[model samples]
Each structure stands twice: as structure tokens, then as C-alpha cells.
Target chain A: MKRYNEKDTVEMRQVYADTLLELATLDPKVVVLEADLSSAITTTKIKNQLKDRYVNVGIMEAEMIGAAAGLAVAGFKPFIHTFANFATRRVYDQVFLSLAYAKLDAVILGSDAGVTAEHNGGTHMPFEDLSLMRIIPEVTVYEASDATMLAALLKQGYKQPGLTYIRTIRKQAITLYDTSELFETGSKTLRKGTDAAILASGIMVAEALAAAEELAAQDIDVSVVDMYQIKPIDEDAVMEAAETGAIVTAENHNVIGGLGSAVAEVLAEKKPTKMYRIGIREKFGQVGTADWLKQDYGLTKIDIVKAVKHLCSE
Target chain B: MAVHQVKDLSLFAQEIRYYTLKQFVTMGFGHYGGSLSVVETLAVLYGKHLNSTPENKTDPERDYFVLSKGHAGPALYATLFLRGFIAKEWLQTLNQNNTRLPSHPDRNLTPGVDMTTGSLGQGISAATGIALGNRLARRDNWTYVIVGDGELNEGQVWEAVQMASHNKLDHLMVFVDDNKMQLDGPTKDISEPHDYVEKFKSFGCYSKRVDGKSTEAIDQAIEWGKKNKGKPTVIVLDTIKGQGVHVIEAMSNNHHLRPDEETTKKIMRECEALGERIGVST
Candidate 1:
């Protein structure tokens, strides 16, 4: 029942940059490290304004993570930024040993998750970053559905202890929450219905909402929930959604270890329901627009609608 | 803090090595090559330079130490024990299940173990970050990290190196235990990261190559590193893979050993003889 839009308003990367700058100004302990992708990640403002507080560690994701851990060890909160794929996979060991195992307070901003890598192609697309981060013990894994959610999640990441990974998207996200509404560290209901529910995250959230709108016309009242916090997943909201008895999980990632898998696991365990998944199959990404990539990977609104229909029929 | 005599430093280094070897026997298996190579370095650190103590464990401005080549956890455990940073009861607990001293240095699990390191190259990067943080916090402290030469093969090490130079992390000092051996084989045969001193220089760090066995040389490097500010320092310690007891040093590969009952008895005997040679207070 919030105001919905269909055009690009503002990029999430800019929101990330502004939020970091604001945090730096608020807390002296907040130091940030960039892996030489500041311009691409759009953190130049923080770099320029907070010169002494910022470090550009070149194109080294693992080293950036290591230094972040060190900063945390030395009693300063550190935030590291890089692309999503490199952030989660390439430096996984460092993130594990240096940050998590060390039990340090640090935040990693892994920009460009899933097909949001757009034209950057397969090597850059991080369809499994969520799964990789979720596997780390005590790491608070998060993905933002829109700019508002990202700003609030980042603020929480700054004060939060232990290693935290914020899976960020560089492109503009369809606005999901209102200006007054803030993001919690769990899943939240976006549109309430009773026939079936769509548990979605990241870019798939808008698709899920669109599908909810389409299903409304068919008298199939579908609930759309934004399951943003992936690791410490909102089981309460999940059980609430499962009350409908039919569920469809959607995301811009592979079904193996992403939103689909996470929801499937919880639903199978807590409350068994007839469920369907709408996401990228076991395939790599390619050069295409975000919308095209969604359609190509069978992650569009149509896919969500189909899955919800199937769940309702079953 | 009393300045320990060089003789005391040498004696402490020998005792620490002896303790590590016995711990190996107790634990059944351990990293020997990397541990022995960094004995003198760890000794010079805990025994002389590091302003650390049993009571001052939580001191914020205390000099920080990071063992980047973390397989050498036993050596550090022995040194921490001798330095009063940890209890002697935990010395023989190396690699034991649920023991505070695991195979790798864990910061939270153990007292005075500054950084949790086992994955190579991360510790140095952490030290660099600590150094930068020290400057930002206006905390007067030096951050020392011991990294194996083979561990330098990790690309992240080079990345940290460049960032350290760029950030002017002058309070950070790195000791490269150039034992020339790694998990697979000789570092040259495995993957040669040729000329570390030159590599450090290229990365804009002040570097030196010194005999790792000589405590005086390590002391001098520390003195120089402290005086030279505006850039980080790297002391490349030229060392043998196994250098403590003659028997272990002579073996073709002493990096790790499974001490069967036969080998365990031989090592215990060697520890006794080495103890006597160093004048263990009997």
C-alpha cells in the first residue's frame, strides 16, 4: 500500500556513498577502504572529503579485507568496498580468517550482485555471493531492495559488531519502502494477501510486487514479502507467509544457494508448503541490460506470476 | 621495563624452541620448519622490544604483534608463555581439542595473541591497517608482523605492501622469515617470489636482509625501523627451515613431522641434551 514507481530515480551506489560519508562524519571510528574501484563503486565523495579516514587499497579485495580486520583489531570500525563477486568469492578465505574468525567489527560492501553486473558479464556477476556470505559463521549477511533500505542497513552495519556483508547493487533499485519506513534486520511484508505469498529479495523484489499486482486481478491474493536479511533470515515473517499454504521464492541469483534455497530450507523445516522457485538456473551471466538479464534468466515479473499461479493451483 | 641482556635473549630463544619441540611431541604433529626459523625473531620481540606484560594485557597503546605465517603457532605460544603474556599451563596444549592455543594464532581465544592468523598474507595486511588506525586514533604504538617468505607468494601480500607504502604506515615493521621452504617444497621450486628486499624496495618500503639466528642483527633492524618513519620497514631474516636441534635441522624436510613412539622418544632426548647445552636450571 506504499507509493510505487516504474522509473529510475537514484542509484543505490550513490546512496551507499552518501551513507558512508554521513557515518564517517558521525563517528570517528568509522574508516573505509576501497579496492581501487571507488569511481565505479561511486565512493569518491568519501575519499575526497574524509582523506585521512579513507584508504584506496588498489585492486586487492582480500588485502582490503585484511586491513579492515586490522583496523577493527586496533579499535576502529572499518568498511571495505568492492564488486559483489570479488568481495564474496575471491577474498572468501581472508574474509573468513581475518574478519570473522578474528571476531572483528568490520563491514564489507559488495556492490553489483547477480545480474546487476549488467554488461560486465559472467566473471563479474555474483549470483552466489549471498550463499558464500551466509555460510560464514556469525557474519550478518544483508541485501537491499531499494536505496532507502540500503541507507538504513548500512547504518546498522556501522554500529554492529562482528563481520557483516552488505550485498549492494550499483544500479537504481525500484523503490519498495517509504521515506518514513526504515529497514529492520529481518524480512518485512510489502503487500499483504492470503491466497499465496512471494518471498523475494534484491532486484526480484520489484518483480515480486508486479506479480502480486497481476495476481490481484485474477482473484489470487498473493502476499509479497521482502526477505532482505539472508543469513539471520526472518523466520517469523517466513512462518507468517507460510500461513497462506502456498509460496513462491524469487531472486536475481541461482536457486542453489540464494533466496530460493534459503526460503526452501526454512519452509521445508518450519512449515511444509507447496513451493516454487523463480531465479537463474545453474547458468552464468552474460552481457545485457538489467531488465533483459532478468527476462533472459527467467527472473522477470512474468516468472513470478507463473510461479505464484502454480503454487496457488497446487 | 628492564632491558634484557643479549645473553638473556639468546637463552630465552633456546628455551622457547625447546618448549615448542616438546609441545610438538605432546600434540603428536606440528609445523616445525617455520616455527624454528622465527624463534630468534619472536624472542627478540617478546623478550626485548614489545612493551607487553602479564598485567598490562589490555593496554590499548601497547605494541601489537601479528604472526602472519600462523602455522608457527607453537613458537608464538612458547614465546608468550616465557614473556608472561600467557600461562605456562597452556604451553603443552598446542593443537589440543578445545585448547586455547589452536594450530593457528586466534586473537579472541588466547590472551595477548594480537591477530588470528593461519591463512597467509592476511596478518601483514592487518598489521598495516592497525598501524594506520594507530595514527588515526593518535595511539603511540608499533605494529610488528612476522610473515614467511613463502607466504609472500600470496598476491594480497603485494597488495598490502603497495597500500602500506601509499598510506605511509611508518609504525608497521615486517619480519620475513626467508626459510625458503613451504607446504609443497622449496619456495623456489614451488613458486619463486624472487628477491624480497628488492620487492619491498619496489613497493616503497625500507628493507634489510640479516642473519635470522643473530639476535644482535634483529635488534639493530628494530632500532633502525623505529628511527625511520614515513614508510613501513621489512627485515628479511635469512634463516634455515629447521635450525634449532642439529638432528631436526639436518632432515631433508622438517616443516612438519609425525612423531611416532620411536621419533617422540628421540625428540624428547634431543630436548634434554639441548637443554643441558643451554644450561637449563636443573
Candidate 2:
């Protein structure tokens, strides 16, 4: 059993900045492009350290994606950063035609995923970013769960080709893995049980683990799997969890076209199972604290626990 | 420039215009206005200025060209054919099923196209990035781009203009195909594009306006842009919507025309006359 840590480690934004700086230091081809969000993502270090290779496009997300495509054409690996909504919804056409349709190689880190936008409210929140990225042909999409996973995916996305989109929260995340852990597989099984399985991603992974712990005391053991990569999702992991007969999916996004929908699609085609999805159901975000918004949107561990209990009874 | 060189370039421009009309005739309908508007600029660049060739186009240090106004792909394809980058037979396959030459420029499909562009306002930003990348590598490669006057309505173009000027992309030369028209109507009626020279000058470029039909004036502006360093250059091409052909140029709605039988015959006659003047048979 992989034990979950209650302690909060480094912030995901700092890890992203440090990893990018390290990558740019070693390889001259690595370049960083920010749409005037260096302070937001803690990448001012990169701006200061690698001044020659860093580009601040100044609040223009469309130009940022286009510039990244050109840099990729010139044989330079570009890592673009912006808010999740700006990265996808604001410049969907640019990302689709210039980067994905043109078959260019670049990595995009879309921070402030979903309710993590907090007081920035509905306009900044991106509930459909994963959905938007998945529809683009051959685009790799991942939602980073913790600091370790965020760092690992950033390193991996650097070597991987084509368009890679990593959705993450910029704040501190709960410690999930050690420095020695490698994330070659898109998913990981942290807990095992027989009654049902809880598949989750992003901020919901921690809630799913807590929900499983609560369900154990109620004499219903549930498996918990962390499904980080939404596109090219780990089907083997999904199938293995299906052996439990009943499944529950939790996410920080809308129930449509996200983690829940991805798992359900695999199950409906390969092996049909009784499943329940716990997420925001067609609602926009509002100005509130992260904890208040998560609770208001039914994204806490209690909702996951209730969902699993309902599935087990049915 | 030598008189013989000017005559050769003029002949090359005529040949490009001939091939452009032939592609539209093959397709039966296409962007006749914008495609014909940029033929002379394409001739001057491919014939005299650009260091890119069929042999060295893949080289990182070679000069690059991006068709920001990508509806004019036929003109670029015709220019590439004349430069030996593509075969003459491919000109007939424009917009055909699974053809390499799509209605818009695609870098992966076309051998000589350096950037894939169709959606307006993106190619200029990409061109800026290419110029910045070459400068980062310490390569003296120049990056050239052609943007439509109407395409400037996209805010991304101004964003790229600000970026190129801020970065001091001295090797980047942008040519505005100021044809005074877009798909709907005249650009002035659609959106008041006041003065391109003043607009580009305010955006921190070494801006100039010239007769787009005069290849010699365009050649001189490019030479002057190369000499003026520490910022990007913008050459505003004063051209007609359907240049080089009187019948098409006279049409009010020549942006994308599906010619009638009589009009098609007139266009073919113009192509024949241009081909004869360039010492080629149509």
C-alpha cells in the first residue's frame, strides 16, 4: 500500500519554475514563454536566470501559442505557460491550427485549474480545458495531482513530442510521492479493495483517498486509483479497477468530458459496470475560498464517500 | 539595380501571375483578388532576395518566408514552382482531393513553405518567433512575411508587431499587401484602416509605402530595410485587389470569384498574353 502524506510540500508553481530553469540550463534549445504570468507561476526565477532564452509575450495568449509554434519550427523546444482558461478557451483556434494541426512540438503548462482559480471567479476558471485539449489530434493531456507528479510530468513532457498540456494548481499540494518515484505509467494504484474502485485526478485524488479511508471504517473496502493523464488514459488501470464491479470517479471539473466521462467511455465499450461520478454538475465557479468552493461544488471527500456508498448499495 | 536584372524580375513576376491564374482556372474558383495582389512581391523575394532554395530550404540558417495572408497560397505555390521547389504538375492539383497544395499554406505538405498558416493574424507572430529564434542561435537568417491589409483587423497582428519591435528583430521584414479590399468589400468600408505607414511606424517599425506593382521599388525598400538595423521593418505594398489582370482588377467583388464562362475565357486570354510575354506557352 502506498501511504498518503498529510504534510504539504513545495508549491507546484515553484516546482514548475525550478524544473524549467534546470532544463533550460542544461539544454540551449529549451526556451520559456510566459504571457505576463511569471509572478503568478513563480517563473520570475527563469526570467532572471535565463534572460536570453525567456520570452514574456505580455498578456497575449494567442501570440504566445503562435510564437511557440515558430520556435518549435526553428528546432527550439518551447514551454509555454498561462492560466488554464486563457491557454485553452481564449486561444482555442491558435492551439488547434498553429500547434496541433501544424504538427509542431511544444509543451503548455496551464495553471490554476478549475476551482483553484478561487477568488478570480468564473472567467478565470477552466472546467473544460482537458476536454478542449483532448479533442485536438494527438495532443497529450495531464492534470498534475501533487508537487512530485507536477515535476515528473514537466520533465517527461520536455522529452515527449507533439503538443502536451498539463493542467495544475499553482498553490501547494499534499505530498504524494518521494523524489525517487518515476511516473512512466499514466496512472498509479494507491489502495486496493474489493467492494468498489474510486478513480480520481487532480485535487480530487486526495479526496478519493480520504473517502476510501472513511469507507473502510463502514465495512466497505474501495480501491483508489490516481488517473493523472486524461487523454490516452491508462486503460489497463481502468480495466483492473473494473474487476471490483462498482466504480466511482471524482474530479475538480464538470462531470462532462473530463475524468469521469473518460473512465465511463472506456467502461461502456470494454466492460460495463455500475459507476457514479462526483463532480460539479453544470455549474459555474464564483468568488470564494478554495475550501468553500470545493465544498459548495460537492468536490470534498464526503461527496466521494457518499457516491461510493450509493454505488455499493446499488 | 541593373536594367537586365529588372527586366528578368519583371518577366518572372509575369510568369508567376500566369501560373496563379492557371491554378484558379483549374480549380474553377479561388481567391483571385488577394492571390494576384501579392505576385510581384513573391517574384522579387524568390527571384532576387531570399537565400532559400529547393536544395537548402531545410537548412536552419537559410532565409525563411511565411505567407501570413494564406488565402493567397496559389500565388506562393506558383512562385515556388518557378523557383524549382515544386513541380509544375502540382499547380493543377490545387484544392483537389488529398492534394499537397491546400487552399491555405501548410508547411508540412508544401516543400518550400516555412510556416503553416490559414487562420489570419497568426503567421506574423510565428514569423516574429522564427526571427527571434534565429537571432538566439546567432544566425543571420532573415525571416520575411506577407500579411493582408484586412488581416490586420486581428488583434494578434498588433501583438506580434509589439513583440517584434520590443525584441529588436532586425532581420524580420513584413510586407503588408495593402490591396484595399477583403472578402466582404473594401477594407475602408469594413474597418477603417487609416494609414498603414503611420500605423507601422507607431508600432516601432521602419515603415515605408511603395507601388506594389513596381518590383524595382519593392526591391529597393527591402534593401533599405536590411540596412536599417535594431528594429523590424514594414513595407506597405500599394496594390490592387486583382492586380496584373485588367478584367479581374475591375470587378467590385473579385475577392473570391467563381467566374462565368465568358469571364473565364477573358482570364484565360490574359494568362495566354502573360505567358507569351514571359516567353512561355500556356
Candidate 3:
């Protein structure tokens, strides 16, 4: 077992920029598009290096998507970036029709995932981005759990065909995977037990690990699995966890159509295990720190600990 | 540029009108007005300008055409059929169940559709992106798109326009089908579109308005646009909704007509008249 580290390493945005620069430098067909948020995602640092391959479409998310479709038509693989809310909710029809419906190849990186919007508040926070993306046919949706995972997913997203949407946070996250770790399997189990399984993603993976450690102190043995790819979810790992007879899903998004819902759908059809979903429920976000918001939304380690205990006991 | 070439293009325009009406009549009811409005432009494009044929239509390096006002797909499909990009039999399948030819253009389903567009104001943006991509790749392939005047109401059209002009995508050309009618009513009654030429010029395009029903004027405007460098071009096409058919043109609401017995008869008569002009049978 790889012990969890609480220390934050490199910012996810930096990893995104570095990986994009590496990919763009290697492939002429790779194009990067930003909707006036180049500085926000640190893509502006590579502007001179990428030259014509980098395009900033100036506050037009819909136009960016349309252009990406066009670029895809002309044999260019486009990587488009914008805030999660703007990328999904603001220009959903464009993403749906121009990119996905047109069968064009493009990867959309939606930074500042739910709760991470922090001071940007409810208007910028997207609890439904996963829901919006998951509904689109053949669109591979992923939530990056850490810096190395973000880099790995970005590289994979570049080579894959069809439409892909990756939800990520722009700031530093708790270090999980090392640089050598690969995310090709879509998930990784950090801890193992038979009492129950704590299935989590993104920021919640760290919390789930912490909860598992705390539960271990009390002699309640539970497992923690990082389910990164939300759409083509790791159903095999899910069923494996379902063997424990108890499961608790945790995420930073709304419970309605995100990780919790995805896992519940698989379990409902396959195994029918006892489960509890811990995430934002029937609420909007506001101006607050990410830590405070996670506590308010019941998305902390304690919340996962409570849900795991309740589900296991029941 | 020759007199006989313009005459041949004029006959091609009539052929496009003929096939467009054939598809609409086959579908029972379709976007006849908007479809008819862009016949001459489609003829001019397929017959003379576009560097694409049935064999090379799938080639990525070939010139691209995106019908932004995708309700006018029948016009494009008719042009593609005449150009041999699609079989004549596929013309009967427009909007039918499990048909490749939907009500709008679909790139994957239809043989010659460069972009799928039904939701208005999106095709133009895709066209601009294609143009930019071609420019970056140093390909001489040109990207052309058509947008309805009513479709201009979507802010995304302007966003694409701004990006196209900013990028100086000289190989890109836009055609605004100023048919002056929308689904609800006249465009003027719905939204006051002040002046397309001036608006496009302000957005950094070399724009010109021409008689949309005339193949010669459209061909000449495209020539002028091709000569202009350092910017994309917008050709504002001044045309009637049900262009080339007097009875349909005179109708107050011909945008999407569910014709009565008499109206269907009249439309079929006009179709026969067009086929006669083009030396083809309806």
C-alpha cells in the first residue's frame, strides 16, 4: 500500500500547462485553445513557445468550442480550456452539437471543479458539470485526483478520439500518485479491507483515505478507491468493492448525477449493495474557503467516516 | 468569367432549385423558403468555386462548405446531387426515418456535408475554426459558410465573426442569406437587423451586398472577395424567402409552408417550370 501524503506538491494548473507544452512541442497536430483564461490556467506562459498552435478566443466559450470542431474537421486535435461552469453550462449546446454530435475529436479541460471555485462563488462553481457531460453520448468524463493524475489524463485525452471532458482544480492538491504512476485503468485502490469500501474522486480521494486511516484506529477496517474516470466508471473495481457488502461514495459535486450516482447505478444493476452518497445535496455554492465549503457540504473525512460506519452497521 | 459560363451557371442554379423543390415535395413539408433562397449561391459554389468533387469530398485537404443556416440543407443537398457528391436516390430520403439526409446537414451521415448544423449560429464558428486550422497547416483549402439573417440573432455568430476577422482568415467566406423571413414572421417584424454590410465591415470583414437570386452577381462578388486580402469576406445576399417561384415568393409566410392542395399543385407546377428551364424532368 502506498501511504497517503497530506503535503501539497505542484499546482494542478502548472501540471496541465507543462503537459500541454510537452504534447504541443511533440505534435504539430495538437492545438491549444483558451477562452480568455490563459493567465488563469498558466497557459499564457507557453504562448511564445507554442506560437500559432495556441489560440485565445477572448471570452467566447461557445466560439471556442465551435472553432475546436472546425479544427478537428481540418485534422487538428484541439485541447480547449475554460472554467468548469462556463465550459459545461454556458456552452453546452455547442459542446453537444458542434463537438460531440458532429463526431469531432477534442478534449475540454474544465478547471476549478465544484467547491474549488471558492471566492468565485456559486455562479462559477459547477456541481452539475459531471451531470451535463455524462449525459452526452461517448464523451469520456474524468475528474483528476492529483497533479500526476492530471498530467496523465491530459496526455491520454490528447491521443483519444471522440469528445472528452476532464474536471480539475487549478490549485495545489494533496499529493497522491508519484510521477511514475499511470492512470490508464481509470481507477486505483489506495487501501484494502472487507468491512466496507469508500469510493471517492478528486478532492474527496484524500478525504476518503484520511477517513479510512481514522477508522483503522477504531478497528473498523475499510477500503478506499479513487474512481477518476466518472463516465466509463471502473465498474469492475466497483463490483469488487461491492463484495464488502457496504459502500460509501464521496465527491465534491452534487450527488444527483456525479460519482455517487454513477456508482449507485452500477451497483443497483449488478450487486445491489448497501451504499451512502456523501456530496452536495440540493444546495448552491457561495463565497467560502474550499475547506470550509467541504465541511458545510458534508464532504470531509469525518463525513465519509460517518457514512461508512452508518452503512456498515446497517 | 465567360458569358457562356455565367449562362451555364444560371442553368445550374435552376437545377438546384428543381432538386430543392423535389426534396421538399418528397418530404411533404419542409423549409422551402430558406432552401430556395440560397440556390444561386450554392450553384455558383459547387459549379465554379469549391475545389471539391464526389471523389475528393471526403479528402481533408479539399475545400470545405458548412451550411450555417442548416435548414437550407435541401439547397446544399440539391447542389451536392447535381455535383455528383451524392446519388440521386438519396434525395428522396430527406428527413425520413433512419435516413442519412436529416432536416439539417450532418457531416457523418450525409456524403458531402462538411459540418453538422441544425441549431443556428454554430456552423459559422465551425467554418472559422476550419479556416484557421487550414491557415495554420498552410493549406490552400478554402472554408465557406452560409448563415440566415435570422440566425444572426445568436451572439455566437458575432463571436465567430470577430474571431475570423481577428485571425485574418482570408480563405474563409461567409454568405448571409438575407431572405427577410423567419419561422415566426418577417425578420424586420421580429428583429431589426440594421445593416449587414456595415456591421460586418465594423467587425473587420470586407463585405458587399448583392442580388442573391442572380448567379452572375454572386459569382462576381465572390471574385471580388477572393481578390481582397488580409480579412475574411461577408457577402450579404439580398433574396426573397421563396425565391425563383413567383407564387411562393408572393406568399406572406413561406418560410416553412405546409401547402394546401392548391399550393402543392402550384409548387409542383413551378418545379416543372424549373426542370423545363434546366432541360431536366421533374
Ranking by DockQ: 3, 1, 2
Cα lDDT of model 1 by residue, B1-282, tens digit: 443434577888898888888788788888877898899998898888887666666677888899999999999998888777778888778878789999899999888888999888899989988888888999878889999988988887888888899888898999999988887888999897778899899889999899999887888889989998789999999998877767677777888888678867877888887688677742
Model 1 agreement with the true structure over A1-314: per-residue lDDT tens digits: 56456534779989888999999998888998888899987888668788788888877787789888888888889988899888888988988889988899988999998888988998899888888988889999888889888998998888778988999788788877776776764887889999999999988888888888888888989899999998888888888989999989998888888777888889889888889888778798898988789888998888888888877776
How far is A287's C-alpha from truth in model 1 (Å)?
A: 0.3
Whole-model lDDT values for every prediction: 0.86, 0.91, 0.92
- List each model's interface RMSD: 0.7, 0.6, 0.5
Q: What share of the true interface contacts does each candidate keep?
A: 0.86, 0.67, 0.82
DockQ winner between candidates 1 and 3: 3
- lDDT (10s digit) by residue, model 2, range A1-314: 45575655688999999999989999999999999999999888668788779999898899999989888888899999999999999999999999999899899999998899999999898888988898898999999999888889998899998999999999987777778878988998888999999999998888888888889999999999989999899999999999999999998888898899999999999999999988889898787888999999999999988888888888
lDDT of 3 by residue, A88-205 (tens): 9999999999999999999999999999999999899999999999999999999999998999999889889999999999999999987899887778998999999999999999
Q: What TM-score against the true fold does each predicted structure earn? A: 0.96, 0.98, 0.98
TM score of chain A per candidate: 0.97, 0.98, 0.98
